[model samples]
Target: MSLCFFDYGYSLLLRHTTEEAIATCIEAIEPARAALTSQLRNTVINDLIEGLTKHDWFTELDIADEPPPVRFSLREWINQAKEVQATVFIAEKQEALVKESWEVLKQNIPENSLRFFTLVLEIAPAVKNMFSFLKDSDEIPQNNPKLKAHAVKVFKMTCESAIQLRQKGEVVVSDTTLKYLGSVHVEKGVIDPHFQVVKEALMRTVKEAVGDQKWSDEMGSAWGEAYDQLAAAIKTEMKQQLEAAPKSSSD
Candidate 1:
């Protein structure tokens, strides 16, 4: 969490600072050297950067500052800020879209989970067999209690992971969860093809839940991309299990 804040600190510093602060900073210490620690300067200079930043260094402006290069360079800073703003803009929008859709799903877990699995089977009927717990006797997920339980768990995991992608920027799967998922996937013969089927079904289910009013290309893309990261994590663990298992040799 602190690390995320640390990263954002750099972006905020560049995106928010004014040309005045830039000029002041350059005039005080050549970007490469600090007045307080420079060998050429035996005496300490004013901490204008700190004071200006805390007081009014970043008094939100409609137009960005275009600072002329002094002894220091502004090219890199300007370029980096532009890149950071573009990336951050996408991440922030995704987080909002994910949270907005997730709220609806959270409100009615059984209904949404049922809808999700129904889409899965509709997309690929054979995919239903992958769920050993569902059994051949179960016609569809609507009447199956296990389907709802499993669906809720999986759907919740997906949304939570998607929601936190920008907040934490990485998946933090536990050892136990990894082992459990790998074992189940191995038993079900789950592979990339099956994963793709489920991913599509999920995207469809989320779109249906959110409705056309809130749904958009960007929202779908956000969920799809986040799920891709999560599916990668699961696949990595499953690959390890497959490699570690003993194989039968030609006799």
Candidate 2:
């Protein structure tokens, strides 16, 4: 049988074995499960069962004859479910923050892009050399369509990463994507340190767009953590690429 079907059957069995107490446990988890896909929902349910089994809570149940191999104690199971419920609650909050923040962000993409590029230049003048396409442009970086497009893409990716991170089971950005991004940067002569500058510029743009009233500490921390994770993944890939590359003859 599919794990989904098994999960449902297990829950029903729990209701019979533990009575109304199981209802309270399910109640605590229903909100979290409501937004998840069936696959992820089943994963969480299975994880909860695994956790209970690891704690040997199932052995404590006094079912007549043999306990159906997956028994659970009401008190212990509820406690374990509460822990998973807390994670789901936090992910929901983070997802809300990302969505609301992006709404504020998309309102003025061009302006924010300008701010990001300007900050990037200010913090790391050397980065200007990397953007050879803008070398001869007399127009300001913010007004440049190419620069604006690049900024928008970066912000969009960041928003997507945050959303993925908030999803059940931490399904954030994929390793393949991160590796490709890192490889592209490596070809562009971009190093791991450059990501810090980019992150700072991006955060500054977000703050400017959202303003202090809407940009709470939680939002800042969430974005900060998300960026850090992306940067780390990219840097890891970059490091691997460098290590695998052929050494120079001079070396």
Candidate 3:
């Protein structure tokens, strides 16, 4: 059987009580499997039979000219179902943490963004040259209209990227935006080293905004993973675009 079938069967088992009901649902969904062939159907049936046996959901009955007896173990099925439930419960808890922390962070986008840029510049002063608006300023100026606008835009983009990463399994989040951003940054001479600086700056900003009492290690990990994915996508596209561009006369 295909991994898809196993996944579907596992999902059904997670929702239903009886193995028979699960089997019925699986068979019922056969019509929706697109171009399913007889051989594939048989394979799926065989896989189900094997899975049921492995999970101790089978029984044998003595009869003439009939299929063998198959006993279903309710206790075993319930145990397996609980495992799936536990996984889902943990995922939901993590998602809730991210959302809750994000709500607090969004309340002060401008402040957090300022903190982010300030931290970045403090860690890597040379990066300041990349920002034209801050060229004449030695420090991240507070309440500068241009700085505030830039910060707000960056914060919003960060939030959007995180949300897309969080829901990636359920929905398709195109990397086109990130790719374009990467290309633009590359044109401005931004390189890979800047990514780590941005990540550190953003993490510090988030921690300061949300407070240590509310932020957990899991939340930090989730945010890190999300940013890493976004950064990687951007860097990859940037490299691809740079490679495709014609070499300058200097090169």
Candidate 4:
């Protein structure tokens, strides 16, 4: 970007942040967090922060009593992005740790799938009503082929979406996958609480798959955060579908 644009943007940010100026400047760029590629967004924000010290007006925004040093959080723009859950910036190390554990998780997918569904049922037996495969049989859901297949498919989709999240800067799955998720949840009458139950079960299942020796609080957090992002994407689609459906007669 041109230096002129950078200076202008930085001035706008200063005004909005310190001066509490009108939100027009900040509002205009909010969409950039979701629309712009991560690399571009990072480049723009980083350039703005890095050039702060070079500006003659740097002292104006600086709050430190001492000179020659400046301290701030991960940059205000980044904080803003995180607040909006848009283009979230994941550290390289955290991203790598998740990627590594994900590979190990794959080895346990079959066994883990059984355990995941078992936990889901155990956590909320009411959830069983939503599973069509369980309607015709007395067999344990974990043992049923249909349950196993569906469980594994869902586990893969949810976890895989989480895995790629670091690169995508958001939870994004194939449009086909999104459509399937949106439709099934609508058909099953799934709600936010159901998603929470499944999320807890998924967390417990992942912990078991990784085993005690390998599992850590950080891993739990990473998986939980990723799952929330994925769930939010699905819910957004579901909301749209529900809104678009023909309204019932209440007139």
Q: Which has the greatest lDDT?
A: 4
After superposition on all CA atoms, how large is the RMSD of candidate 2? 11.7
| Residue 91 alpha-carbon offset, candidate 2, angstroms | 2.9
- Span of ten consecutive residues with least summed lDDT in model 1: 36-45
User: TM-score: which is higher, 3 or 4?
Assistant: 4
Candidate 2, lDDT over the whole model: 0.72
Each candidate structure's TM-score, on Cα atoms with residue i matched to residue i, is 0.67, 0.63, 0.63, 0.66
In the range 1-251, model 2's lDDT, one tens digit per residue, is 45465469557868576757777766666544554454475577678766765774355665567656655566667677777777666666666786688788778776766677788888887777777667775545556778778767766776677656765434366778877787888899887678889888878887888888898877877777778877777777888998999998883
Candidates 2 and 4, the one with greater lDDT = 4
User: Model 2 TM-score?
Assistant: 0.63
Of the candidates numbered 1 and 2, which has the greater lDDT value? 2
Residue range 114-193, candidate 4, lDDT tens digits: 78888888888877878888866554655688889988988888888888887656886988989889988999999999
Of 3 and 4, which scores higher on lDDT?
4
Predicted candidate 3 versus true structure: per-residue lDDT over 144-196, tens digit per residue: 88877887787778766775564443212366775678778887888778889
lDDT tens digits by residue: candidate 1, 42-135: 2111233333345543443343355553332344334445555567567767877887888887888778877887887888788777777665
**TM-score, model 4 to reference:** 0.66
**What ranges in model 3 sit over 4 Å off?**
1-91, 170-176, 249-251
Residue 54 local lDDT, model 1: 51
Clashes of each: 0, 0, 6, 0
- The residue-level lDDT of candidate 3 at 229 comes to 78
lDDT of 4 at 7: 50
